[model samples]
Target: MTSNFRSLPVIALLTILSLPLVVMYAFTLVDSITDAEPGSLIPSEFTFHHWRFLWDDTTGRGSVWIATINTFIFAGSTAAIVCATSLTSAYALSRLNFPARRFFLAGVIILHAFPTITLIIAIFLILQFLGLFDTLIGVIMVKAALELPFGIWVMKGFYDTVPWEIEMAGVQDGASRFMVWRKLVLPQVQPGLSALLIFSFLSGWSEFILPLVLAPGSDAQVLSTYLAYFLLDDSLEVDFNLFKSVGLFYALPVILIYLAFQKKLMNIYGGGSKG
Candidate 1:
């Protein structure tokens, strides 16, 4: 009797939990099938035109190639810079001792919590002063800096979970500090690094505010800006279904990648994030 009662509650809880997801999926499915104007949710019939149209795009206005490349470049460069700067520096903070280390570590974390939007004006002025306003490389550098602090903090926690004695043993064997970290420490934190790469790439990939504020022309524009272009275009009629189609295609690859690696991300960001 007790077992049956417990099972009933468990089943009830699962049904309740699943309700929101079912609703959301139904909404997305309806959105995909509908051909009405941007505001309408109902469709006369199902259509595959949007999906098929992505490949046939020659309008120049809807070219996925350009925006795809921009996204890749931004995400790739940001991940590289974040991993390079954060991995080594964070390892140093975690394993090595120095004066003012705690203060420095706290500041690193505090800076990680700083919102990216708040940096826009300051970054804009700085880039303007350096004569790099609206440059792809400049945006890449800013994204890298934005990613560095959080990446370092995530890595620091991952490093703590690794036994320091492993690196210490390397040191006692006459291995230089640099060599010990490179060969020994890094290998232990590869999972966290992978998670960091995925996350930092996603952030750079999806970030719109900074690039929107900073990108001076199409030369430096990424996917986010390109998406907004459709809404802003006065020359062409706004096509809501086409906009949603483009969005889904652009988002599909990243979504798949995230889903594939989602199970490990919590551990990367949470499970091992403490001293």
Candidate 2:
């Protein structure tokens, strides 16, 4: 009780520190709706001109709808591929005996340790060689590949926590190895699976550098690239409200996804599977 009471000051301090970020978001939100001049505290007038761009993209480059569909494809495919491959790779590393297994486990984390920027040149060259450059499918492959190392390590951690006796019991009940894995082992790591899905999806959703460098222009643009286009196009007449509107629009999907799966995020760090 005393400790709880003593923590109030710390909490108050943290809240105070967070005020600037809250104010910034509030300002942006207000700016998106009102015809407020840049750096003004109050709006001169309110209008929906900023949001109207969603249905009617006036930039004449490409439709927001197309970019949105492309984003969903890129993010969804990246998550699915990363989760699927990571599950199998992590399971083999965690449950099976193989030479250099520990080394490989360490190696996956090591691969994640290198900064992604350093590998962009190599990735670009590889994609070019494979005839995948400047295409959405190519970007999907690159994003999935980048996400694999972390996903494998996370799933491996969860897999290591599953009891071996469960698998043996399934085997004793005339279940094949694949069946045991599918039925018993996989459910034990549902939390990890959920975490990986959200992480991989968000990673691909917000990825800027890869999409900008590899899959540029209107044809293969994702929401991130789409938002950037607003900045590039507004040189002569900068519309801060429009930029803020685009920023909010780009972030809406990720926000909704997180809200939908926030409960499962807590489960990721919680204890092992229930009976």
Candidate 3:
């Protein structure tokens, strides 16, 4: 009871600090569903008019559902690829003793340090040369490739936490290296893997520039790019309420993902510090 009492001040401080963000989000929600008088900040009437984009194809870039589907595919594919490649690569990096292993690890960190924007022109030219411009697969591949360094580094940290005895036991029992890794090492680092998957998915989902620059077609559009269209329209009268609704819609998945995997996400730091 005393501990709980002592924590109240910290909680109160946090709540006070968060009040503005809470109020802003509340106003955004209310504004999306309610209309204000011409000159008033207060909502005057309740309506679903701003959410009409959910049913109507008014954006002229195709249905928001198309963008949503493309986003899911792009994010899902990147997560899967990052997970698959990182698992094996990190395992090798953690357990194997090959020449220049330290140098390779250093190179991985260097690659991740470079901002994605700096390489956009080169990536754009390469995609065009490969005839993959304006395609979802092209963007997915690029996102996965870019995400690999971080994924590998994180997974390696987790793998380093695993005991060698467990692997040796499996090997002594006549299990192949693949079987040992698949059954033993993988389970121990499940938290890191889960965290990486969520991180990669969120990274891909929130990505705006790559899709905007490399895959500009309506069919390859993701939610982030779709949201930009609201302001890109040449009309002088922009519907701010509609923009808020679209922003909320775009954010809903990320919010849900965080709520669901928040615990695993915390484990990322725990695993990283182990190595």
Best by lDDT: 3
Cα distance off (Å), candidate 2, residue 134:
0.7
TM-score of each: 0.84, 0.93, 0.94
Greater TM-score among 2 and 3 belongs to: 3
Model 2 scores a C-alpha lDDT of 0.88
Candidate 1 lDDT tens digits, 130-216? 988898888999989988989998888888888877877999999998898888877778889888988898889898877788884
Candidate 3 or 1, higher TM-score = 3
Q: Rank the candidates by lDDT, best first.
A: 3, 2, 1
Q: Extract clashing residue pairs from model 3.
A: none
Q: Model 3, residue 42: displacement in angstroms?
A: 0.9
Residue pairs in steric clash, candidate 2? Answer: none
What local distance difference test score does each model get? 0.80, 0.88, 0.92
Index of the highest-TM-score prediction: 3
Off by over 4 Å in 2: 1-3, 6-8, 37-39, 233-236
* Model 1 steric clash pairs: none
Report the lDDT tens digits of candidate 3 across residue range 29-136: 999999999989999999999999999988687899989999999999999999999999999999999999999899999999999999999999999999999999
Give the count of colliding residue pairs in each prediction.
0, 0, 0
Q: Which 10-residue window in model 3 sums to the lowest lDDT?
A: 266-275
